[model samples]
Target: MLEPEMVAFVERTKSLYPSDRAVSTVVEQRAMYERLAAAFTPPLPDGVRTHDAPFTSPDGHTFMLRLYAPFERERSSGTVLYFHGGGFVVGSLASHDLITARIAADTGLCVIAVDYRLAPEHPAPAAHDDCLAVTRAALDGRLPFGPLPASLQLAGDSAGATLAASVAMRLRDEGVKGVRGLALVYPMLGVEPQSPARETEADAPMLTLADVRRYSALYWGDQAGNEADGADSGMRASVSARVAWTIPLEASRYDGLPPTLAIGVEHDPLRDDARLFAERIRAAGGQAHAPVGKGLVHGSWRALATSPGVQWMHGEVCRFLSDRAAE
Candidate 1:
């Protein structure tokens, strides 16, 4: 059964977004997403300090990075590199300002939000490379994050989570150390459009299978239908396999990864993506915990202040980050 609040939330979204509306171009879809984000994103809490900096990707592309720090903290609990979700196409640091602020304040952690390039213009390696570059910079203590963090972690929501997972894989392969953990919220891990949750939540309120396919097409580029013959697509598979990080679930290795926490929403098609990821991590001898928000829908991070269940879930994430950072 759907929660009454979620049902009403869907209705309100429909009134503004109109399910019948059609978006043919990436520009249109991006505009629609920006509108929704602006309308629904909650206000950032008070006592959180924010600033922006410029980061140049290893590929020489420069982008803006936003940092959120808890107010008046004598020392931070830790630092986290946060990637925002928009199917790798639409989100910005501004769209997720509330989430980062709350995380910084709640966990007493310094959160750095990356404004990576979007797809259908830049595509797969574009987003992935940008995130990996930022992570590398952070790990090397070159990102101007004040002082070296006591511990560092990677985090993201949806597509951002995918980036974090992939980056973690690369870090593991490179023998990089000091990454405390990863926190993935409703991540989009692979091209499994026929997953069970996809079948059951075909028309989930906030996100749908069609929406997933659209985002996949945008992010994965021409590999949208090359799943069966990964060899025929040559570059897509080769680049994605250079390191097990590209498609984390299909990675050749999952051992030696830092602790992980994956959170999923019950009505989301990607719910099992989180479940299976955690299961695999544990199978590979890494600590992992996945919690599902029953009676919730995708994109509920926007409801952090409005929904009691989401608030509790956010608290759980804070607690997890705090515990792992302390360890």
Candidate 2:
């Protein structure tokens, strides 16, 4: 059952993004999503300041990175590399500004939000590669921002969470160290046929299961079948080993990941992704904390101001970052 505030949050969200409206093109989808993001984005928290800087990836692609720093902080405990969620197609640095700003202010850490390339224009591996490059640069203190605190962490939501997890795994494989923690919020890890939430919460408010399949197709450029077929395609299978970059669940091993906090909202189809991911990490002898937001739905991060469940989730994230940064 949904809380009254979450119920209102769902209603407000539906008004901004009506299910009845047909958004046929990627442009339409992106525009609508941006409008929604703007509607819910409040002013930055009182003690946080943000600035944008240009970053050139290893492949010579230049993009923006927004840095959020808390006011009057002598030294940040660590830096967080954040990725925003719009199923890899629509979200931008502006869309997730408030969330990152609050994290910076609440945890006294520097938060850098990546403006990675979107899908249908720059498909799978493009966003993943950009995020990986940025994380590597941050870890090596090679980003233009100059010397950062030695401690670093990866954080993201939805598709962005998938990128964060994959980057953590890849870095582990390369034996690179220094990532202290990971925070994933309602991550879309993969399309597993038997995942219970995929069936039970298929039509959950905000993000339906069909929406998940459509985004997966657009991100992977998988047109082998209709959007309803989800991510199960010949091309996806052909590159399963490499596909882990886009779908973290495809990774063969979950060992050696940093301490992780994977938040799964109860009413979200992707809820099981977080749960299963934590289970896999623990099975491999790593530490992971998977918490279910009792009455929340997908994308409830936008409701941090009004919803108690969202507030609790945010608190959990802050504690995770603070603890890991202190270590």
Candidate 3:
């Protein structure tokens, strides 16, 4: 079934495209992202409206956010802070259009996808800090949407997944509460890339070791407050790369953090990363699990319009959010 699905999936993806791609080197990685982005033109559902608006990051680079909302539906379960997964360098809200809308529609939630600065450009703390700033401001004092539920959720795929954890982690560190849940879709949580998922799916068709290396190479260093200098990142030969850019959830205790949902793909390289993080979240005295797409591949949710895995994931994420909202 997976093989047949992949065959059909590739056959159908002959024309989709993404709007942005991370590019540490405009000559290589960036160009690769552009091609992938150009091939990701997913069609969103009928009531979903996409918009670009300015957001202020703590560092003042004029951050932006992309929102996916059901224009006619005034009702929402809650607002979701989304981050796109592109190995932290490529991937914009556009890359995950189908997934984002499916999330909003299925969960009955409004999704605000943070256009956080990517790696090799706005690396390390910049992306992390921007996400933190947006989340904190979004949920401050007054009700976020004119007296609606002020609760929020952190949602991201791949690189965005890392930021999701980083954002929640920072918030937890800062004593900020009220997050309903954290949903990481095949997240890239490790800086060293030694997860079994990478070894197991070393040659998975949809994603590969090359993709990982490229993504890592793109996100290989810390670009803290250096986007304007035209600086290129330099990889460190250190013992604590994890401390700089990785989300070591395995070491964190979920004291006041919200419940978490870690999604993985059987045929993707980041599967193990998701599994490991989820287990740690549970160990930390919070709830976490890979809601039922274990047989699928990375970014399966992006194919929600075409695959059973994605559709099932859509429903599962909503149920998770709603169930947690009740808790």
CA lDDT of each prediction against the hidden true structure: 0.82, 0.87, 0.66
* Preferred candidate (TM-score higher): 1 or 2: 2
Off by over 4 Å in 2: 20-22, 192-194, 223-241
Largest TM-score belongs to which candidate?
A: 2
In model 3, the worst 10-residue window by lDDT is: 14-23
TM-score per model over all chains: 0.92, 0.93, 0.81
Best by lDDT: 2
What does candidate 3's lDDT look like per residue over 1-327, in tens digits? 364554566545434322232233544654564565545555667677767778765466677777777775456557788888777776665666666777776666677777778776765556677777788877773322333345678888877888888778767777778788888877777764546766878876566777777666556443222233343343332323434434545344555667888777778877778777777777777778865364577656645556777667767777877666555
Give the C-alpha miss distance for residue 178 in model 1, angstroms. Answer: 1.7
lDDT of 1 by residue, 57-162 (tens): 7778999999898776447878899999988888898888878888998888889999999987887778889988988888888885567465889999999999
RMSD of candidate 3 to the truth, in angstroms, is 5.4
lDDT of 1 at 284: 91
Cα RMSD to native, each candidate? 2.4, 3.2, 5.4
Error of 1 at 257 (Å): 1.2
The order of the candidates by lDDT, greatest first, is 2, 1, 3
Q: After superposition, how far is residue 224 of candidate 2 from its true place, in Å?
A: 11
N/CA/C clash count, model 3: 10
